[model samples]
Target: MAIPGYDSGNVAEFALERAGARAEVVAGVVPDEFGLERSGRDPTATALADAVEFVGLEELRAVDAFRIELVYDPSALPPGASPTDVGIAVETDDGWERLESTVDLEATTVSATLGGRPSGSTIVAIYDGTGES
Candidate 1:
């Protein structure tokens, strides 16, 4: 599925595999700035783009896994932050959880394969000078 950006002209694509039931997915980009708090583990973590929301994911049951890919503009990143420093984060009950994701520098995209279906908001995050890139 291709999710169009609300105003940034960016697009996010996702794929659900091994879903137990049919899903009624509605996805869109939240063009507003997202203020992500700094964590002890990643004090320099910052939001690189607007939030992406995936609604109706609750309709999917017993899904094995899903993959999401977000495209972002390079200009949106802070100075000295490369695309390699970018990762995917999902809003959880506790807080925003960063997912293990891979960055395609050539495509300006970051992707992650999440185990099971996640019903919440997601965003592109960058950990400045963390060397995770």
Candidate 2:
């Protein structure tokens, strides 16, 4: 079995939110799991901890195993939200939407905001298009 690592939500959930399909979500990052953000919540922190990866299934000799890692910015959460149980949201063409009921998160991280309550991370959204960016 192939191995994988992540800091947040899993693959199936993330994809469904993106594709507007159906999926189920669980908690914690499993050793072998992928990740996704349903693009929901008014001020969620899934963006920082969010990550997406796609390897040509054909390259692994038709292997069906994959992995995803998440690392979210804790500040994005509400004032009294629980850091342990993180929520996910997806942004679509129309507007911010919620992933199906099956969506869930994997791992999480929280850091004190600089003279502020809490804010979402800009690492993913402002990526410079380095292809790797």
Residues 1-133, candidate 1: write the lDDT tens digits.
3323223233223332221111122234322232122232322246665555554455554544456666656787777766687777767767677777777788766766655566454444444445563
Candidate 1 colliding pairs, count: 0
| Highest-scoring model, TM-score | 1
Residue-wise lDDT of candidate 2 within 5-122, one digit each (tens)?
Answer: 4223332333333422222223333323333333333432334333332222112222222322234555665466554443233344454333211112333422111121112211
Clashes of each: 0, 26
TM-score of each: 0.59, 0.28
Model 2 alpha-carbon drift over 4 Å, by segment: 1-61, 87-133
lDDT of 2: 0.30
**All candidates: CA RMSD in angstroms?**
11.2, 15.2
